[model samples]
Target: MKSILRLAAATVCAFTLLALQAVTAQQVQIEGSVNLTPFEARGITLSTLYKVDGEFAGKQGIAVPAPFTLAAPRRDGQQILAQAKPAGGGPIKIYFATDDPQKRIFSSLQIIPFTMKTDDPQKRLEIGDYFAIDLLKKLGENRTTRVNLRRQVTVGGLPAAEVVGNFVNAEGDQLLVRLVAVAKPGSPHGIIGIAVGHPRQGRIKKVEDIYDTSASLAFDTVTFN
Candidate 1:
């Protein structure tokens, strides 16, 4: 009778283990078929463009529509200014929140063309990472005091990189800077970079706030020709 009981207990344990394995297999199959990244699962779609007067309007080939107004151009007839002799590619386009350089917030956009093929998502992301780091360096010019955040993100359905840091400008004022670089969707030979800078204690107090505002106003609304 004792031997019979032992055999019964072993059978029950085997069945329980089999049941657990079956459940785990099912879960794995479900996850594989419905794979989703955290950002995608959260339904975050970043864009900087909006419609305005039935026409898209933003600097650097991006625009937006009504109910979304961009920061006032620095001065009349100079809403968009070009920065000459950029590190590479075409001149960088800049838009300022105010005319006063001491207390103003500014954002810039640039399109950098590349010769390498970037059809693969991973390759594109790698290129974007490189551009992002390069952009940060150009912005800081070796005077960065602290870096707050630097990580990968998805922008307009493309892999991108974002960097936020604090640096002292030529004017000797500490400024917060946010930069993002992403491969242009459907365009394998180009990358788009967007950057924002403001006084460290300016109206926008948080680095993430700066990033979010730029995304909604300029980065998210970009459209390439």
Candidate 2:
């Protein structure tokens, strides 16, 4: 009965592997006082409108429009609006909060249309560097600092970067910020995704889970319309 025993062992191994995969693939959830509505991922087509003189009249200039998907969470008491461009599409503000800065939730994806001059090989940009520049502008030189950074590829095999860190808000509270960026060669715009959450030690897991879910949903579910 040696052959029968071998078959039984193989079956047991197969089942064990599947059980491990299921555990690791479990869905992540947010845990904290502030609850956020689930994020919905969707795709939209983009196109440019032109005047009779061929003048640039589209929200995204004269570039040919394409389709891209973005994920965003529903805002409390606010209606979601979509804006389209030749290279990007998403809500005006992915997340917003009032009265308390620490309680704010955010997730967003955007594509930056790069001009011919900026797209040159010599001038090509690393996604994370672009994010740091933008953050400096918004948070000022003294308030923004790079905490943890990693260079990784997106699910679509596109070049990408991710950074998780903290910045001081105007109210003097430390807030955590997470950013992910993806770039495709010769594209009109590079994709930039961002998420922000609470900074308390007990809430760090929830904040990170939110960011992970937002990024996973956007990258894994996005499709060309």
TM-score top scorer: 1
TM-score of each: 0.53, 0.46
Q: lDDT for every model?
A: 0.42, 0.36
Identify the leading candidate in terms of lDDT. Answer: 1
Q: Put down candidate 2 lDDT per residue, 78-192, tens digits, no spaces.
A: 2222233311222122222221423233332333322122444333344334543344234323535446545454535555565656566555545555555544466634434
Write candidate 1's Cα lDDT for 22-133 as tens digits. Answer: 0111121100011222233234332122222123233334222111212211222222333322333332333333344332344444333332353667755655555555
Error of 1 at 92 (Å): 4.4
Cα error of candidate 2 at position 121, Å: 8.2
Which pairs of residues have clashing backbones in candidate 2? 112-189
